[model samples]
Target chain A: MSKGRIIVIDDEDIVLISCQRALAPEGYDVRIVKSGMDGLKMLESEAFDLVLTDLKMPDIDGIEVLRIVKGKWPSVEVIIITGYQTVETAVKAMKLGAFDYIEKPFTPEQILSVVKNAIAHRASE
Target chain B: MKTKVKKTLYSLTGKLILTIGAMMIVGSITFWYFLIYYQERELLKNSVKYSLSFVDYVKKSTRYGMLTFQQLLIQQTVEAIGSAEGIMRVRIFDSKGKVAYSSKKEEIGTILGKNDPLCRSCHSESVKPRDMQSWSIRRDPEGYRILNIVQPIYNEPACYTSYCHVHPKEQRVLGLVESDVSLSLLDKAMKRQKIAITAFVFGFICLISVVLCTILWNLVSTPVSILTQGMERVAAGELDYTVRIDTRDEMGELARAFNAMTADLSKAKKELIEWGNTLEKKVEEKTEAIRKAHEQLIHSEKLASLGRMAAGVAHEINSPLTGIVTFGHLLLKKFPEGSQEREDIEVIIEQANRCSSIIKGLLGFARATSAEKSSANINDILNSSLNMVRHKADFFNIKIVLNLDESLPSIRADASQIQQVFLNMIINAADAMDGKGTLTLSTRKVVENGNPFAEIEFNDTGHGVSEENIPKLFEPFFTTKPVGKGTGLGLAVSHGIIQDHGGKIFVKSTLGEGTSFFVRLPFYEEKA
Candidate 1:
């Protein structure tokens, strides 16, 4: 069975592609969106167990998305992916009910473990 | 003569002496004149009385001869009396005013006319015979003063009743006896007395003037001269001078008062000099302090600008590094486990991670500070700092010697900030050694000016900075590293971090030898 359903939001194509490639091999469903607004739009139509969002983006920021997702879909978990500069704000997102925060330039193993932990958290809840 | 007298009059003492001398001279002149006049009057009266008494004696002695008509005996008596001492001559005039007898034989029969000076008073019609007994002063032929007395021989009842020579009562005056007394001796005595008294008075006045002048000079002029000399010295800026006056008078009191005033003035001058010196020192100290503060302000401004630039650059670089990292890992997973491509991908991932960490450091510099404070072990922070750069140090073939004090107390600090400072120092040391040297890290408790501090020293045995470059070592953008090897912000940011923690960072460098950087932080005591 699939580990969990996750939506990845990022402005960079390589981040989206890397997330898909890293998650697909582990037997999980992953969707990619380019911006926070697009990720929220996708979340309205689809039921996701976890949300992975970039803390910095052009259309909207990750903190607002984390707040909106946590408010609208109470069951979904958020994991904020932050670049080096936005790590402090990323931690703030965690306090705002994000499941966890991850610093940028993360390894494939690092991303997979965090996603897995987030899914397990949803299951436990 | 006029100028000499006027000169004497102008001078005080001379004027006084001259005035006294002048008074003495005038008084002597007046007294001499009165003395001569009075003595001459007395001498004239005494001479008149002697002449009258001698005339009476001649008349009495010649009375028996005259009653016997003995004219020769009477003449002999007159001659005898006139030859006495101080008697110039004697004459007897008959009733017709002819000289009946004379002491000088040439005047024995000389006739006296009514208009003659001797007979003018006694024989004049306006004169009564009883009022004619008078005297007069005359100068004789030899210029000798003489007193002449004229006495009318009066006939009384006995003369009229005499048997030899009887006269009627109506013809009571018989003849006149004239006696001329010499006055030269009296005049000579008065002249001698006048000369003696005048000489004595003048000498006395001169002596008194000399004595008075000497006394006045000692009492007033000497003291005044000393005081004037003292005043001149003081006016010439010699405040230390004092006047010496031995007299216990007003001048002495004045001298004492002046000495007191000069002493006070000297003291005030000394105090003013001291105050001026102190003011100059204070101004110099204040100027030095201001210069130090100005340098600090400029350093702070430079750091603030650099921090802002670092933040913007960090934000721009971090996103791209993330993308690069993510793609590199994805590519690594695509390759087989033993492939060279996987290894290349690992290298790319490693480089990207390095870039990210650098960006994280830049972010740290940007944020400048976090409000969070916690008690952290300095030894632990030091170890972490070494671990972060251990691989780089190994790659550079550099050796690091640690001399941490194990018993160092924990301090209140932000671990991450302290860690950044350490890391920067380590990296700089590696750079300074040019990838081949030893770095000695030492930690100890230090006391500076009675304040306890934790000292961390980083000694590097690398090509040391020159003396000229040592001062600029901590300045922003000042780097000795090659173009691509250093950003030049490492030491500046490190210095800022240490300063923010209320610590000091300093360096000691010697050319061609090595450099040591020291960081001193105040010890944090737990609050009760």
Candidate 2:
């Protein structure tokens, strides 16, 4: 069976590239965008089982992307990523239908665990 | 102007001179009157006595001339008689009062009859001429005169001769002897007495005037002049001079009083100068204290603002660090067997670990962590503080909403301090609502008084603070919260922090509506 399709959005090229490289070998299809607008466009044209987005971005924010994903693709699991970890942002992302939140400089085990859990939840649903 | 007037009015010399001059004038007048009156009375009495003695002398000389008339029959003898002492003129008249023989030859043989008033009164038959020893005559131009006795002359009575008995029955009156004396001598003597008395009185008045002037000068003028010199020195700002006057009179008392007053004034002036200096020093000290307080307030504010921004900086660094950590772990999981990729993954993992440590350092900076501070976000601070009492809020059906601004700047601050502030605010809001209300936390960028800053707001939809309590809200230990739930240092500390950053914190509330607190801090511009 085909692994889940995942889209990763980050303002920093290094973070975006790293997320792509880390998840590619995990039996999943991954796409990366450096800007929020590009991520939204990719979400509209293509299909994604899960969207991982950085919380702070220019021209649009991760919270807006999460909001749109939940409204348009309700089944898709949304994870918020942030370099600056804040309880307010985490709570805000969760209220806007984000599946989970991940802080920057997170261990590979932590990211994979959250992603895998979201995928499992989607599959069960 | 007032000082000059006072100086002139209180002058001692003026009063002393005036008193002495008045006394001198009165004394000189009294002396002049007494001297003139007494001298005039004495001279008048002496003149009268001298005139009486001169009249007695003239009377005695007239009697001598009468006795000498018996020798006046010879011409040489009469001429000698005419030169007798004090007898200016002498004549003998017959019984009919005619001049028979005269010492003055011009009046010789002239008839002196009863037609003359003196002769008529003296020889009247009704008058006892023999018993009347003398008579004085007074008439204008003739002046005054005294007449002596007229003797009866007869041949010597022969006691046994018949012719002598016959001559006794036929006795004849000899010519009256007369003497004339000029009154000009007595008048000259009286005039000389009047001149002497007048000179004595004038000289005495002059002496009295000189003495009075001298006394006034010594008693009044000299002391007054000394006082005037002392006053001049005082006017020139010299306060050390002492006025010395040695009299025990009024002027002396006045000098003593003046010196006492000068001493008092000098002391007062010294006190005033010292007071002025002390006042200036006190003002300077107060100014310096105020300046130091202001500087301390600014320093504290900077620290508080840095604390707030610390949250944002921690988050920024944490994001990148999370990514590196994730990527490094991913490489480790995929390349467990030894390979170039595994070595690269190891290096990446090491650097990622280093980056995590750097982020931790950044967190330390953000939280002001070296001194009991730790990195904390606004949301975390709010949540942790609320979580401590989250069960209470929930039990009371209170809903907490944190609308933290996404672009909130990172600040370096003490975490426990901020947490304490948040906890107090939440508790207050919850209590204000009677544990059933909406508690909203909001933050935004704000500029206050032309200074850019960040503003965090804590709003509660509850019974709000009254107008009276708003001004006192930030005062230490001032609280509307129930006694056990609030220490009242929350808002005060927050206010102190904001003030330290050169910012302000304020509150607005409406009765039965809500209360909102806004804390502003100076903006931190990132260095290039």
Candidate 3:
């Protein structure tokens, strides 16, 4: 069986493709969406264990998507992926029940390690 | 403040009155005096003519009486003449100065002396009375005035042939006859004339005063007063004031000229003020432009320097640091789990990552951290920064002193940016002291030119910078540290951050003494 179900949301196709390539071979079920609205639809239609969303996007931002997910499904954990390295937004996301946040330009190993940790945290809960 | 006007000794009107009154008094006195003198002289001449004729009549009428030596007939003739109107007394004296007959019967037997004034007029021809030239005036016992006329009796041929022992023919005079005439009528007329002259003089002086006052008030005094008031207003800076003297005299001309001069002065002052305002605005604009250009030049120069440093770091150090970390991570993947070799590679990777992050931090310094400003307390920022550096200070055996003013006002600043600046300053101070001295951090409120600012100071007992090097301290990439110890962008970046926050950062140092770095930020007030 796959390690756990996860969805990656981003406006950049490259970011979505990179997340899929990095987490698929690491023994996790990875789904990719080009917008926060698509990510939320996918979460609604399927059983997703984790969500990774970009902060700035064309359709609903990661913060609002994270709020909607946490309000609906308390079991699923959410992680923010952003290009801005500002601490205030990260702290705000943490306060809003996000699992973790990672800055952009991450390596494949870095994405696998974060996905592994997020799934492990979900299993423990 | 209004000052009281002093009363001068003589006003213009008073001078006019004084001068006119003086001339009137002198003219009236001279005219009346000459007229009175002429009247007195004419009266005296008329009285003298009448007295001389009466003496000639009495001499002829008494000739027969003297020839007969009839004392009764002579007495009767003298008495009859004396009893006439305006006659006081008549006296006849013999050649021996005896009063032979007189109109006054009681004085008939009186003997007259040669030295008596009535006798001396004929006896002593050398002297005339001081003011009485020929006749002498006397007053009766009842205070009536009498004019005495003296005539000398002559020795004639009939007197020598008379039986009564007459004098010799060589005798030219026999006796003196003194006739006293009453001067009551002349005195009364003189008194009446004097009263008329005195009344005329009084009325003349009164008329002169009225006419002089009227002329002066119309021509000089009132108009001059108005002109003087206008001058006072002008002198008091009321340039719009006008003298309201409407006469056609010199005073009016002077008032008109003064009003014209005030108008000219007012116009000139207004023009000067306008020119001054325009010049001041122009000067302000020029100065502001020059100041803006200067700030822009310095900022652009700093940006250029930062750009160069960023390019160098990103190319050389960044590539190598990233390569080392990547190679160490791949070596970790090949190593067996929990092995000594794998832990060693982890150390290398961790240290390499640290190097990479430091490089990233340097690049961020070049960006000057777009400040997200808020109202922040500088003292609190100092406390947190000190907490971060306190362990490092203790490790170096350096003592830290915090002299913070609790009353320091808040400043509009980015807390994190200011924290970075403070941390850099504290580390620099520790470096300056070489792990052996004291660091003193302080904050205070300072007001400069009515603008309030929060001032933070970091002082260290270390080898201070030389005077020649003080000016170059803020320039990027300028450092006194040995190679690889410092990038030297810390203070320059701090300076840029402070300047962006509308603040100032400067250093004061003296060789062989100590160093102080000061940062001042403008105090914040809530925007409405």
Q: What is the TM-score of chain A alone in each candidate?
A: 0.97, 0.94, 0.95
Tell me the docking grade of candidate 2: acceptable
Per-residue lDDT tens digits for candidate 2, residues B1-528, read: 999757644555445544555665566557656765676556545533443343343334443333443334343444455576534555555556667556677777677666576576666768766523243424335452222323333323331134324333345443345544333444455456556655665666566657765776688678888888989988787886779997899879988988888898899989999999999999999999899788766655654565456456666666566666666676577775878888887887777676565454334334332233333455566667877988863426877787878777755455565665566677777778887888888878776657776677889999998999998886655767654455455566565544544457789999889999876655556555
Residue by residue across A18-85, what tens digits does model 1's lDDT show? 78877888899999999998999899999999999988889889999999999999889999987666
Label model 1 with its docking quality class: acceptable
Fnat of every candidate, listed in order = 0.64, 0.64, 0.00
The sequence of per-residue lDDT tens digits that candidate 1 reaches over residues B13-129 is 566656766776687668767876787788777777877887788778777777777778888887888888888788888788888888998987778788888877665778754
TM-score of every candidate relative to the true structure: 0.61, 0.49, 0.47
Which candidate model has the greater TM-score, 1 or 3? 1
Against the unseen true structure, what C-alpha lDDT does each candidate score?
0.81, 0.67, 0.80
What's the CA error at residue A13 for candidate 1, in Å?
10
Whole-structure CA lDDT of model 2: 0.67
Candidate 2: residue B294 lDDT (0-100): 88
User: Which ranges in model 1 have alpha carbons more than 4 Å from their true place?
Assistant: A1-46, A53-65, A83-88, A104-125, B1-282, B320-358, B369-371, B374-412, B426-452, B481-485, B523-528
Which scores greater on TM-score, model 1 or model 2? 1
- DockQ score for candidate 2: 0.34
